[model samples]
Target: MSVKIILAGGGTGGHIFPAIAIANAIKKQQPDAEILFVGAKGRMEMEKVPQAGYEIKGIDIIGFNRSSLIKNIGLPFKLLRSFVQVRTIINQFKPDAVIGVGGYSSFPVLRFAQSKGIASFIHESNSFAGKANMMLGKKATKVFVASDGMEKFFPAQKIMITGNPVRASISLSSITKEEGLKYFGLETTKKTVLVVGGSLGAKSINEAIDAGLEEFEKNNLQLIWQTGKIYAEKAKTRAEGKFNVWVNEFISQMEHAYSAADVVISRAGAMAIAEICLVAKPAVFVPYPHAAEDHQTVNAKHLVEKHAGLMVKDNEAKEKLVSSIIALAKDEAKQNELKQHIAKLGVSDADTVIATEVLKLIKK
Candidate 1:
């Protein structure tokens, strides 16, 4: 019999992309499997999941408003409504298993699945676990994690350290630096720096890069900048007529960007870190200060402690980011050292491993 599965969760690319990777891996192993995604209504996953060629159902849900208590007045009603929607989805789909990849929507779907005694799994990409995942972990059949020592968050017996599943386009990329530069209409001779601040973009990183555009030019460094939607117009205006820079709201083909870059500046989101590690590029991370439990900082610090990468705090990015990146770009020895160390941390087959395990357990 063909297996049916529901992959739930995703507010950001960090969650959505990994879920897609896992879904793809599952399809590769079980060609006849039917997969569906459950995400929060109007969230990025509602749009991104379909783009990845998977069907999805959206629940009316929102996370707590940490910055404002007034904004959370409707929280209970939303959660209650989402559980109702999840019940409808699960009853209609009758999935053989459910997987939560860490987002607000994942909670209702996974919680409902566990209540029904359907096989349920979770992928917690961060060292620091989310509150929803922690609660779900108790009843989860399995909990896949990016690193070791996750027993503190999930049941020790349920934890599996498979590492974060990096998008195949990156982990398996064969694009040459020259080919990548040509894709961006940049010169192969100039050193290139790739700047990415997640799918929503980073205001501090954007401001710093904007302020230091001339400095980058002075140092003969070029850039392939993914400004996200929020800063796209401002970045374009700042980069106008600059042959050394290519600025866009998003880079659909990030493999090219990774290949072209000699140095990288990025937010320390789990998926971003995984991709960067796979690409083995020298990177300077600026962790988003407001991430839940400040996990982004923990992610960056883990690498920095091992000398695999460098970091600048979010508030310091405007003053220190450009100079740090420029110095790293110019230092081939330092770059190579970082590349070697960081490459050691990359896991190329995590998707396959997670998929195989999920299928194996569910079949039993």
Candidate 2:
């Protein structure tokens, strides 16, 4: 019989895409391997996983509401119910291993699997780990972390630094810079800035661009702005035409955007940082301040401290994001320096490395 692996995690694309990549790796190693995904009901994973050609089961789960105490009243019941759901799913799937990629749903699935003495693995994508993954690290057979010095969060013996697995689109983008510009309907001669704040969008970054639209034109720069869902219409109305800007809710083909970009302004999420490094884009990160333990900032600081990138705090984004990126775009010297440094930090084959490691443990 082929090996059966259970994967869990996801609220955002950051967690879901990595989980899918690992699943694909396992499938490649053992074509007959049975893979299953567990995610929170109504979460992005519920839709994305199936689209990736894997089966996924949804559990009743949610995280604590830090901003609203009253919203957490149903927390205990939801958690308990999710555990019950996990138990049922695991018993039915009978997985040889469970892999978690850090999200609310991961807690229940891994916890239940650990209790049954089944092997469990964890992928901590952030430089600063989440509370759930830190707790799961104690018993997980292997813990895959994005950065080192994570002994503070997980068992030192179990931790393996694999870096974050980026999408194959970015890892294998062979399109030339000129072709990339053509893909975005922009001139190769004009300096271009790409703005991304993850799939849902970052208000601060969007507002920053909205505040500085005139400056970009004055600076003779073009923009390919991904305003996310929240500010799509708002940015569209604000940026309607003039032949120099492309504004949308999401850029479905991000590899092209990354390829076309001269400079990028974005949120400092782990996955975002990984892709930016892979593309070697000179960037200014505005960390999502509310991320657990301010990890977005921590992730950006890791690059900034190495002179690999720049950081503008969430509070400072509106005032500083556009101006900073514009400055870097105009200054070829600074852009080249940042590009060289950030490229040095890029781990382009992380997906293969992480997938290979997971298979190694199983093959043994």
Top-TM-score structure, candidate number: 1
Candidate 1 local lDDT, 27-122, one digit each (tens): 999999999999999999999889989999999999988889999999999999999999999999999999999889999999999999999999
Stretches of model 2 off by over 4 angstroms after superposition:
none
Give candidate 2's error at residue 240 in angstroms: 0.8
Compose the digit string of candidate 2's lDDT tens values, residues 65-155: 8889999999999999999899999999998889998889999999999999988999998999899888889999999888889999988
Kindly provide the TM-score of model 2 when superposed on the true structure, using C-alpha atoms.
0.97
Regions of model 1 farther than 4 Å from truth: none
lDDT at 202, model 2? 91
Alpha-carbon local distance difference test for all models: 0.95, 0.89
Best by lDDT: 1
